[model samples]
Target: MPGKRPLNAAIIPSAKRERKAITLDIKLEVLRRFEVGEKLSQIAKALGLAVSTVATIRDNKEKIKASSQVTTPLRASRLTRHRSAVMENMERLLSVWLEDQSQRNVPMSVSAIQEKAKSLFDDLQRQQGESSQTEKFSASKGWFVRFKERHCLPHFKVNSTSPGSNADTYPDVLKSLIEEGEYTSRQVFNVDETGLYWKRMPEGMFISVEEKAEPGFKSSKDRLMLLLGGNAAGDFKLKPLLVYRSEDPEALKGYSKPNLPVIWRSNKKAWATRAIFHEWFTYFFCPAVEKYCAQNNLTNKALLILDSAPCHPVNLSDLSDNVRVEYLQDSTADSMQPMGQGVASIFKAHYLRRIFEHILEATDGEDKATIREFWRNYDIVDAVDNIAVAWEELKPATMNSVWKKIWPECVHFQSFSQTDNIAWLQRNIMALAKNVAFEEVVEADVGRLLQSHEEDLSNEELMQLERERAVGEGENEDAPPALRQLTTEALSVAFSHFEAGLQILTSNSPDEEWKFKVSRAINDAINCYRELYNEKKRRSKQLS
Candidate 1:
């Protein structure tokens, strides 16, 4: 009976074939009437969609979920409190260690203390069960070690049981002597000798080159032994004192030069003569001070500050009542000597500068004779020349201005609130003045010598010129023979010799060191020039 009803022709025809699907936007007006807060089931039923699809969209909606492991405000505060407590405990432990060492004169080894503390702390932590699981009390161990080292070791001093001598009277004695006018201005002088050598290398320039294996490589054998004397006015009187020994005892017999002592032979094979010391004081130091005082109409009471050099001996009987010796404490020159702070540094700086500059300038001359003369004759004239040049460059206001700048820097005096030693004060002032003036003179002398030696171009310069000439001429098949020969001769003579000199200077053999190398290089250059001249003469004759 149901089959009797006929199906619609268009709808029934699609059953035999698949049809394309289309989507359409729906109006929510009908669906809005479903419920006040519509359940997904009710909304899906009204929309004619599956309950599963609506439930899927509802489940996917963003929702905030709190974690069970979150760090709350209370937890954070607890952590901070724990850290502070641990740090405080560590500091307390360190303080105990320091106080124990200070109170007890016993010294405890750091490693022993660290191990003991670490074991005790670790055990305490283990019993608590709330111990740091990562590592048990690392901060405590570190603090224990550092506390013992920095605070404890330096405070320990050896106690002396023996009765000490009353050595404090020396200062009082010295003060009395100074107040009594024992040291007159001119007679009170400082005498000292400084050893200078060519081995004095410039700071930052004394490089240890690996390829050059020589030990004690010096630039030259040239050296000077100068004895410098100065009174309270800072006037420098220098003498070249030579120290040598003669096998014959008769050779050491009484003889004296203007500023030098006669050769003194020794009875002891291992030591220099006692007479050398006697000679230094009797002939050089005492006479200089006495003469200076006599010339200036000053008293002969002089105070001398000297080191315990074997060459400088003290005899209370021989010394005049006015003359006194102030023996400085060993290794305390840095704090005690006025020269150590001021004059020495300035003198060395100027001295080295002049010496090096003189060496460089002298090397520029073509003739060996000229170079030799310049090197040997570096005395008063050299000093004057160098000083003039240095002064010119410095632009110092005047001699008085120079003195004013140098005096305060060189002299050290106690304040009026404290008693000052008059003898030391006078001596330092004079020493400062003399050193500054002497340095100036040396600088002036070097400058004048350098000025005189200045020429158009040296042999090395001429070689460079020739090289430039060849380069500028370009690639010419038939360049002038004379021009080519001149250039070749110049280069061949200068370069080969200079190369040899450089090699010798940088050699490893101790005997063939820099000094010897420089000498050889100079000789080679001279020889090369001679050969070039001879070859030129031969060519000239052949051409004729």
Candidate 2:
């Protein structure tokens, strides 16, 4: 009654407002700013978001970063809690098919794309055996629009009316981009995948009939995928991205994964999957490029060139602000991808040579019996070591020269051609194979062995791979066997030996300073064991 005397004194109620949504791009920027010591309140103010919202975004940085890789319509501001795996996989594969169709110049319509989407979704459902309960997907106009947005595809002919109508103009496109961006050889990179049958020997090594008759005797078909890439400059070779069928192979039980030369990952079929590729891009590739830029005093911005592989996510550019991803024209990869331009062939040559070297080292002039024994015991760890050594053997000049076909300006040396290098490696491999008692192994056989990796898997092989895929989906992985623990008595004896060795070194030393340094280093090295020994002693005392 008192306030009613004046309209200005009347209390008014405010309406509740809907929450604002943050896009992946904005979130990434916020994180970047926060990382560089920007205040949360300031970031919030700059981005027109609440301080609490900025803080929340910071707290969920990891999930947000991961979502950046797999999410669709990456620029969309709406917050999507989850997307089905089937849908994600379907879209990725569908994108690949669309690209393939485009490459072939096959005419495509809206209806055709919808039909293809439906077919792909159905195929995925059947593969997962969830068709019965799964909701029907119509692949309607809304979905098509979203899909296009997600893959950054424009409204245009997804296909052509005639074959070869769309000429391989990727070379010109890349040249234009290079010039426009003013990028040097070091700023441009290419990546590609190849198959590695780690345990496979050339078929020239004849298998006994009994061995052939044994179950699962197809060792040559036991394969893993390796993703190899380096900058056009060839001075920077990214660590090999190796994918195997098993997460923790028996052969690698005691190995520390982080310390391995290759970035190891796993897929049920040992094929390159989108998830693995995403991991490689975000964790390995980006960090590697960043490190390279910092060391070379170059700009952080980079251009990563890739083929239209199914494993590669289309929205990779959204993941990093400084990196731009460009795909080669479909079917032009073999002709234009720097990795395909003798880089992979050269790598295979190196790997094969390393394998033969391993045999030589193990059998010492390749005694057949010793070689056979070594081959039988050879495991994934051995393959990884060989791969590491082989990768290390690739010289920068060789890497730089491989780009001659794609970016000739990057090439500084032409003294050694890929053909010459490969022939030399093959000749060495052939000679080594003969020493290993496989005199029938020819250069052609080695070439075939390399090409065999590209062949399609047989029906039986696909079935086996599918079973593994199922196991992985079900998360029924077998645990690696635990190592035998050292007994207290063994530990005590080891410590005694270590102390005795230190005392012997002290007594035998001529220089006091050198002796002290040596003794201190040895003691420091054994400190971990010393702690373990003390722990065991304490436990024994407690038991008494």
- Candidate 1 has an lDDT of 0.40
> Model 1: residues >4 Å from true position, as ranges?
1-173, 203-227, 236-274, 316-322, 331-334, 364-544
- Tell me how many clashing residue pairs each candidate has: 22, 0
Residue 224, model 1: lDDT of 28
lDDT of each: 0.40, 0.74
Best by lDDT: 2
Per-residue alpha-carbon lDDT of candidate 2 for residues 1-544, written as tens digits (9 for 90 to 100): 3444444323333365554656677788778667645578768877899998899999999998888767666444454334455666667667655643443234468998788778777777777785434657889999899889867864444443445622355566778998888888899998888777787767666642224556864555578889988898888999999988777888899899979989888765566767778878876788788778888999887899987766788999998887899987654565667777777777777888888888778878533547667777888899999999988888888889878767777788878688888888888888877776776677887888777665544433444554454545545332321323567789778879988988898899899998999988887766655655787789889999
Worst window of 10 by summed lDDT in candidate 2: 475-484
Off by over 4 Å in 2: 1-168, 207-211, 365-369, 467-473, 476-544
Candidate 2 lands at a TM-score of 0.58
